[model samples]
Target: MEKQGVEVVVAHHERATLRAGNMFLKIDTDQARAEIEIDAMERAPIPTPEILWRRPPVLALAALSGTALGRLGEPSTASSAAWAAVGAAVRRLHDAPLPPRPGSGIDELATELDTECEWLAANGVLSTDVITRNRRIAEAALRPWTPVFTHGDLQVAHVFIDGDEITGVLDWSEAAQGDALYDLATLTLGHPEHLGDVLTGYGTAADLDVIRAWWSLRSLRGARWLVEHGFEPNSPGCEIDILRTQALRA
Candidate 1:
């Protein structure tokens, strides 16, 4: 446990820590936290229980290297309503006025992508060319889309529900400003049956091509990461298979 003021944050699991205060903490690298804080201050309202302590790079790597996949059944009508509420909340979040753009342009994305590809190569995962190519495809798809504050890691687990209402959204460590449709696409592709209600709740239909491409990119990224982390022979192999299937369908 670590302390910042009266807050007592506990690292119970690998990827996340609990701040015994009004907020939650994600155990990511210093660099990742910096990026997330900048993103929040610019785009979304800064979430509470912010960064209080840092873990070593080795621990951080162990914490956030893979995606969690489960055969989530369709949410009940109550859950459906909760999703809609969350969608509305996201719309308001995106609608919030943002600050001036930073001097560091989106060019940083290329660096991050290159780093991911290089890491994959170091791990003997796959040819770097594939990563490069897919990134190009993703970039091309995002070109015509307007940018907005995006919850880069939106997933079912991050959504909090209270009866038929979405009480909260969590995990902003990967949040940033990007094409709003990219966020929607990630949600839709990850949970297709809920797409209709989510879209209706958000009151905007995403461009099909953009959504497909983003979904494809997300799938490839997950697969590549799984391979890189030596998870090919492990239970996570199922995740690779599922993501591959999603990508192929796209």
Candidate 2:
């Protein structure tokens, strides 16, 4: 008999996700984080994969139906309406009741920015000129914001859609009370050209400069994490590329 092939969902720094048939097994070293993700899913307004089962270091969930909004390096083939749907979904999420935790504070993020910039320079991961220039840009995002429920790692890959409707939002482990602009910034990180569509559906004016600042902030903060996790932020269509693009726009 042929065995069902196992698919690697994601293997990263802290976790490994795999799928066999309709069930996915997410194995993590941090059980508390998994519990938090489960809690967030319960409170979230939108759809998430069904929790088939759970045990320490692993949780099993059913696979979802739709394709992701887009990948980091690829152009979104989804309609503008699809992007709008994501915007609307994010708005609903922000409006939902606050999660039990708060994300990183300004001081923490500032400290992270300094440390990551130094690491990048020390390791020769990026040029000092690139690091210094983007550091200045990232400073603007350190201001206070009225916190909202945030999908802390709201990368385009985490959002799934089918025909202009968001099917599910994934990876709730990072969900926490945080700035709404951070969510917006994360969604449109690599795709600035789609910012207007997202903002249109978001139905409000925001600090464009702050959002841009988040681009640098997010990229800098993530570079180390990605490297530690056996990924490269400097690859085309990745965080370093986003930073390069941001610099070009400056």
lDDT, each prediction:
0.52, 0.89
Task: Using TM-score, give the best candidate's number.
Answer: 2
Lowest summed-lDDT stretch of 10 residues in model 2? 241-250
lDDT of 2 by residue, 1-250 (tens): 8789999978977789998987889999999889889999999988888888998888998888889999887888888989988998888899999999978999999998999999999998888888888999999999999999898999999999999888898889999999999999999988888888888888888899999999999999999888888887777888998887777777
Candidate 1 local lDDT, 1-250, one digit each (tens): 8655533333333344444344444454455554564456345652322234444531211122112221233333445665676677678767766433322234554455556656656775544554455555556453544557777767555555656565545556566557677677666655666767777778776666666666645655565554544445223323334344443453
User: Which model scores highest in lDDT?
Assistant: 2
List per-candidate RMSD values in Å.
7.6, 1.3
**Pairs in steric clash, model 1:** none
Collision count for each candidate, in order: 0, 0
For model 1, give the RMSD to the true fold: 7.6
The alpha-carbon deviation from the true structure for residue 116 of candidate 2, after best TM-score superposition, in angstroms, is: 0.4
Error of 1 at 87 (Å): 1.5
Candidate 1 at 146: error in angstroms? 2.2
